[model samples]
Target: MRNTISLRIADFLKSYPPFHLLEQEELKSIAEEITVQYNYKGEHLFKQEDPCKPYFYLIQQGAVEIYQNENGKEITLDQCDEGDLFGLRPLFAGKHYSISAKTLEESIFYLIPIQAFKPITVNNPKVSEYLLSSLASNTHTPYYTESPSRGNLDLTSDIHELQTVHYNKKLISCSKDTTIKDLAGLMNLHSVGSVVILEDGKPTGIVTDKDIRVKVASGNWDIQMPVKEIMNSPVICYPASLTASQAHLAMMKHRISHICITEDGTPNSNALGIVAEHDLIVSQGNNPYFLMKALLRAKKTKDLKKIRRNITALLEQYIKSNIPMTHISRVMFELNDATIKKCIALSIKKMNTPPPCKFAWMSLGSQGRKEQLLLTDQDNAIVFEDQDEASYPDIHTYFMELAKNVNKRLLKIGFDYCPADMMAGNPKWCLSLSQWKEQFSDWVKSPIDDHILLCQVFFDYDISYGELNLVNALADHIFKVTSDLPIFKANLARSALLNPSPMGFFRQFLLETNGEYKDFFDLKKRALIPITDAARVLILEHQVKNINNTFERYEKLAELEPQNRELYLSASYATKVLLKFRTRQGLMHGDSGRFIDLKSLSKEEKVKLKRCFNTIGDLQDLIKLRYKLVNLI
Candidate 1:
């Protein structure tokens, strides 16, 4: 029998993980052994290196401050608020506490006996995993996640743009009184493009390659004169912590290169390093379309890798500029397509001869649909001209090798290897035009979950490179086959409804119940995927080919159904708004915009999100009614 107090404790524990994984009986039993403790504000729970407590603590109310002594100075590590679990790491590790935990305010804690807790988690993998994550500092609110995209999507594949600029640490600077000739000698010896003029070890001015050309070489000033006479004053300075995107933007905004790094983030401090525009271009990949041209000139795969870094920065720029996702997607898709084509062209040159036959490299799934805002796994396939056994083996070998090179290069450039092994390199996907038609026909006729999934992902493909006729022929065959199979359309519609309504009965956003992102709202899963999935199924029913974009699909739906025009138009607006919202979140957090921290949202943002969910609910209702999917649900 459980007491009221024990039951209440169990209820609170059930909301969080490890504890959440426990059975009701187990929870009640464990809760009975839990002891309650109270702490005043600014009171220490445990100091660093203190012996581990017999009980692990859970925050019942208020907050806990976790800090560590780093180099004789206290550094705050994290804050554990309501329902947050702490002081469990040392108990599990059989060691002293590595961090000091204290109360941030007047707090109540439920201290569970480690003896009771250990036995419960012994056989529970999820509990054990959650405990390990907590120990590793991967803390999240009981029913919430920490950052966007940590729930599912890894929108920040290239963290380069999000991180601090990798500046040149070598200080190529001279005293302000140094002669220009001496500064030139120092610059030549270091092979630096710019020379920082330091006054009392602090950067005061900078002289660049342009200054050397215009001011000194042009005889506006003599090289033998003091460097300060020709040096540009009030040098653009930034802190060492300046991000790649910020550095790039600063250079463009100030119309100058070579931003000097200072300790205090001002020229009043010692010059630490110099970050040039050329360095930013070399590191962050200056512009997206320019990076596309750079891809063409790339002789090695590493060059493509560098340009891809720039592409991520450009993505940040696009999001910050509030560019419509449609325009951004188109530009990004073009850049990606251009990269693939260039890689293929280069691979052909590496071969003993050109491709024996014309073929089309097809970008499937998100890339196929031109909705890839982030660089995810490469989902692609190949379709070649049909040929008899005579020329078949040669063409097959050529395309296979080409795909292998392209896939490997794509991986090197940031796209993860698709876990499902769905790429042109896979023989099942890499096929002749007739074979691809057969594949599509088989999927449509079968209409099983697996087959329907294949239809959804592969059917959206566009010609990335090679022959257009091959892809067009395949697309024509697909619409023709899908038109004949109503069951397939029904299956897709069911899949769209699988995402569930994003909002709850109380009009609150439905949060994920578990996984690493427990309690975190999945914006992509709940909102974006629902809309995109609905769009895909609806567009497929109308036999509308080539519009893989979610918003565009809704737009086409509006045009097709005038009676349901308002609903379709509303879905279109909602889709665009949701995409923009997700991108903004992802860019802000440097994560995939899938999982969102609801608490971090402003009141206005929350209202906008709720409004969007309302629209999504309506769209889903439309899906249910139009497909007659009430029975399926």
Candidate 2:
């Protein structure tokens, strides 16, 4: 029987491929009978039409190319690398090989007996499904037919075709006796460049900004000139339902910038609104000022909540409009930050008095990092001044009361309470400056479980309000303490690598098999958190303070670590792409943007996700090497 060496091979095999579906004992039995074959570069394992061998191959190292004859031409079908399985088709077909399998480079492969594999597949549905799915994905078919059959078929239809129609609500008009100045005032009030001369609400000519600039403004006509003096005869009018494309075409056909929307299709009908060429472009949902204003004026939690809905709606519009994710993320972050600040301000007003002493309310975790796209949980803290011994307790009590109100209101506004309860409402987290320093000192010196938990939660504290000095002092204390504790950084690095990559061997998506999110990929836990944790740890190691945004942190890290600059930049790019993807998914699915439905993604999206995984893999490698975590796993 094969011994420990073969068992090791079997154990590795059991982690991936068809072997993973076998019972442990059954797999070990197959492994015991397998032969390890080594091939040099350009060596052929099997040629076309050769008799089927008793053994099927699993690549141990290097790569093997599978080629099939197409008419008179030899076409390479696939390349199998380490841990990849190939040459299994012959076992099932029970015929001579249909393709030639040759080594692309020097390689080793475990040859499992076809006789052993056949028995295991007899009862293993998962093994059968996995093998069949892999085979189907590797085969070439008509592009249109192949895609619709795959799970990602729906994403093609998800691409929204921009609608042509738009709202034109800016109407302009003036009485016949109205002076040129009054006509101009009417146009300016409506923020338009033209005024229609309406005599008894019938067909009339129109005055444009060009007329004002040329005749009235240039002193060619008196300021008191009547509407008849400068108005262009025969107004151009269209119905309100004109699509954006049609509007553009009409404007181009007539060589005009504006189209007057009238009650009827002609200039004889009363004008309702004007559709300008610029309006069509701006109508594609480039307006964030409206949402910002709504947030600022929001008086109650319900009002803000209603406006928050609008913000998300606006976000969906932005994504659908194909705006750059960077611009959208920044705008969305600003709006969310402003909303939180407004909440805090309103909360403070509801309190008995202004804060007792100087303190800074901080947002922690994703909110702290400004990478929170979909609202998740409330992770926040408070840092008050170090008061005298007698007054400290009273001050702490007052801030805790304030925090309670704030946290409760925030919860009402839709942010879930932190599962760990690491919120400002917790007296343990809401502390004075000296108390915070003492807390950090304890965490750094001990590095215990609870302390590590706190470190992970609180390390990303971002100043949200109060005295900047108070927050700066807290950051200074953290840097001072953590700079001396390399072990803490190492612990953080280990934690960052806790989630193994979401990509399996052979580059297939690794999805959650069970739990609340069965069959869905946990983008937050599997992808985002690891990168965020890594960025925080790496930045802390660099003694950088106050930069909590994940992409920004990585960009800063790239600046600091020149050797790993490319990797860091790639990490930053990946973080943005994943965040944008999550935001889009959340907007589409109406959830917290944590779980992604792999079946809904298109092939291009799948490729983008794979690219993100590559970045994650590279970053994980850096973390492992830097922390010497090879032994930890």
Candidate 3:
């Protein structure tokens, strides 16, 4: 009897490697015995010390990371993608695995059983030579490394970029007889958003959260109603062997979230699993799992710094894929936040005892706003709870030591030190709640040029760690002082309008006139800052809390004032476009995205940027109107 699954497996295997060297009958025979396996991101296929299975693995789809544990640091030896082979060493050695192989992304693997294939290799010289070549060397990975013998494995590198629509393998499904109440219970128990209704071991229909919300919760049906009444029949089905682009197109065409995978890519076959938009997202280059896996196993600052390097690769991929800048920023923010929190925790462990007082590490400026894509200088401060005057010295010393360690570790992890000495390690920036309040009051009361500049950077501070109540209280105090004071607000707004529309009298991009970036476009100064500053001041005027992100602030503003929705939305879109532009420029040049060479930009790129600048002009003009800063401009 022929199995469609094995045929599909054979079809994939015949495209690459020693399998490609084999005859059709021989490949089919081997594929029939091949075991299909699925693994999620970060799962170990085989550990370094584990005995080899009867089979070596081929990455049918997705990536496999082969890494070595060296002195407690996981050094990534190689990453294998589609049609790549690994674990072949044990076949010849008959010993424990040398390196740990794990999934870097949600993957489909075809297991080539060694026991069943001994005769085939004995007959085929090319197959034996290939297998021997891999097992012959300790560090040689045929699919990963390019060498004289490897001779262009012809294995696709871009498969990771555009193939394999990652499906949810958990297979959360229900029978047609299942009641609405029972199905809901099952969904809750599994913590899944949808369930496939199965009949005769094949998917017949599907039910999702929306179905329950509209059908049962909206008073349309009782909980006792069978799911057959609710489940949408004629389910959208595809084979497990589908590409990411294909799945994405299918999902969009069908207007559905869940795509059921069946053996024959039809409703009549056995339900294999599902593919979701969320799954595709998780499997993509923006995958936090890969970085987090590296993060957890890291024991030294250099290891973490290596992880940061990988983050650049992820960012490059995201930008290349044309993923929304807003989404990319959020992922980058989460990764950076996690890295900072881990750094603080590591710092605390370095201390002799626990912290003497509650403290919050605040990330100021770009990081605070969560728009930090390209890493630049660190801008951070420490906010601790007020302590006894006598005990202040000891508490301050302990926190100072911890800050020094964190700052050093952060520096090692690729964040350069602030030129102006604004880090928490500095005594002036590190302060108690009362001291911070006093400082903010002083800034507001003074509103001098230097003070305003300091306020622009400091006001965006977000608590990275420690006591939240202290930070919340400080936020309230800052808002209370600035909410009623018009001069402070107007001054801040005026400064936001200082950078004039990012275009000079010639209507071309206003390039920096002097310094290292002379004749280059100041991406951050000329465009990004004006919109960011405007978002900050306007959102503060509305007294809206918790919207620190420039784009998000504009989104909230659009919601708050429906009349100026278009203006706020325009500003929001401009911010996103500029951020993406800056991030791409930074990635290309390997800089902080502050400076851009005008010669590098294409005509379309230049046009898009100037359009965003026009929106910034509109924003700066609105600030002039609202704050009555006609004289300042």
Find the candidate with the highest TM-score and give its number.
2
The TM-score of candidate 3 is: 0.59
Model 3 residue 210 distance off true place after TM-score fit, in angstroms: 40
Best by lDDT: 3
Which residue pairs collide, candidate 2? Answer: 164-244
lDDT of each: 0.77, 0.74, 0.80
Better model by lDDT: candidate 1 vs candidate 3:
3
TM-score order of candidates, top first: 2, 3, 1
The TM-scores of all predictions, comma-separated, are 0.57, 0.61, 0.59
lDDT of 1 by residue, 131-184 (tens): 754665523222112231114222222234545788899878887889988988
* Candidate number with the higher lDDT (2 or 3): 3
Q: Per-residue error at 346 for model 2, in Å?
A: 1.0
* Model 1 weakest 10-residue run by lDDT: 141-150
For model 1, how many clashes?
8
TM-score of 2: 0.61
RMSD of 2: 17.1
